[model samples]
Target: MGVLGQPINFGVSMLDDKRQEEERLQVLKGYEILDTPPDGAFDRITALAARFFQVPIATVSLVDEDRIWFKSRFGLSATEVERAPGLCASAIFSDKAYVVKNAIDDPRSLANPLVVGALGLRFYAAVPLVTHDGHRLGTMNVIDFEPRDFNAENEAALVEFAGLVIDQMEVRLAAHKAIGSLTTLIKTVPELGIDEVATVCAWTKKILIDGVWYSFDEFLSQKLGLTITHSIHPDAAKGF
Candidate 1:
């Protein structure tokens, strides 16, 4: 019976943790962004960041409830990973910035899948993409195969680059939210419930906004690498 009482306290703590997580996640989701098919603008940015730092990989990653999704990537991959296994998860721990100079050498990254897995990435530096209102959307990261160090100048440069990434994310959030409201204007305004209707409504918002400008793919291209061209087929052109 005493142990049963202990469970009550544990339950309260769990609820507190869950509430905290939900609030944080709401802030993350409030950006009303992340995870769509693709876009040219986004691709360009990630590629440029990778090349600028001379790293083999770069990503604009969003830490979702269960997974860290890649909005853009330059050198290596686009697949999602479990949130518990993400190094960028640590970035959300602080208000500033985070870096992992050598993945294999550091205790944090020694077991990170992005390091030991197929990509063979040994180095990482993550700059959080933060909103002006202080919402942390995700990270702008540069990954490399060799163990190395960045001078003060380089760190400064990466920080600046990360700022640009945040700029894009802010715009994306605005665009997505607007689209979502407009679509649901035909229905009802969506709130926090995870009902299927709400999810679909959110997606509808995504499609409308994406088509208006660049798709998510185009945004990622510019963010990842400069080489991505946002040209569309003559018939497919919708004036975004």
Candidate 2:
């Protein structure tokens, strides 16, 4: 699967689906994004989504094990809602946009608390934030109190919005991972001077510590607690 390309892993056996769900949740956890502080990037996206859709609410929602956590919200007060099969939970099942033009008449949402209760939600549309590895993380969605038509163009635009959300997540995850690596490196080489990193043989890529040479990769794994893996780059694999 490509980051902003085709969808995958849909329509599988029930048992395989269960395993996939577990893997999906693991991928979500790896991001370490849940329950974190608000981010301006996400807030801006949701705000733009609300304005573009002319809706009262917009959100970047992440479906956790028991709740739908809002990474950012626009025009909505509550930070999160319980994970429900009728709402964001359902949206994450596919890469396509999920919509309810009129929740009052849509059987899928007829009994939902947000639809029948105080919030009185009447319209909703969402595009799932699917990762490059085919894991559906959550959604970039808009909500309205009144029903309205959502055309194909609108859906296409929403998909783009979802892609943006995924792109942001990818950047954020890389940053976090890099920081973690750096912190580990610093701790591992505490005696190294501020201006100097580690003593390494350039050609061999081996680090020297206390007169012993160690493979840079092994040194990182042993001293920094890092796991390294090799794989083809996503773009390069496209040629096949």
Candidate 3:
């Protein structure tokens, strides 16, 4: 018996965590950002973070299932690293900032390779890149060769940088979706002939999808990542 007179099912807890991770990966894939070329916009963010924190390394890290991919990096040559028990992997578990002022002395980070190995990382700080719908994608990271104290103000600034990163990601995702919709619209118009200028029904609000009619609500939710609801406006109701 446990807290609520039920057995503590550790396996069920693990399964829940696994399911959540699967959903988070699905959200990450929709961004279409993995393995893509670097954007100057993301690069600028990393550069600014390094300068702002006076750290030797700063990166926008995306945590894939087995690896950490650097979308943008400053003062670091490698673009990725294995997903281990330290750094971004550990940071993504929480929404708050993760800081290790002195990895050499902190029991939590003492055994991490980045500290014990040749790179000799002494300091680390990061804020998780969380989506608007509450999925943690990765982290905005700052690293240093020498340990230093990071106060509350510094954490707040890092959090703001994370917000900027997520903002840019959302903008990019919207553009990607818009481009896809435009492409579909163009392909459908030619096949439908000059008589039909659009693939959507004006009255029913149904869209032509692969020669089949699908509700506009379905199209928006499936293709554009939008949530749909039904309602009748007073002005529109008068028409009936």
lDDT of each: 0.60, 0.74, 0.74
Error at 126, model 2, angstroms = 0.6
In candidate 1, residue 164 scores what lDDT? Answer: 73
Q: How many steric clashes does model 3 contain?
A: 0
Candidate 2 CA-lDDT value: 0.74
Model 1: worst 10 consecutive residues (lDDT sum)? 6-15
Per-residue CA lDDT of model 3 for 148-218, tens digit only, reads: 99999999999999988988887677656654675576466564332434465533546676677766456
> How many Å off is the CA of 192 in candidate 1?
34
Model 2, residue 80: distance off in Å is 2.0
Cα RMSD of predicted structure 2: 10.4
* Cα lDDT for residue 189, candidate 2: 70
Per-residue alpha-carbon lDDT of candidate 2 for residues 120-220, written as tens digits (9 for 90 to 100):
78898998888887777888889888999999999999998898898888867865665566546666575543234556553354567667786746666
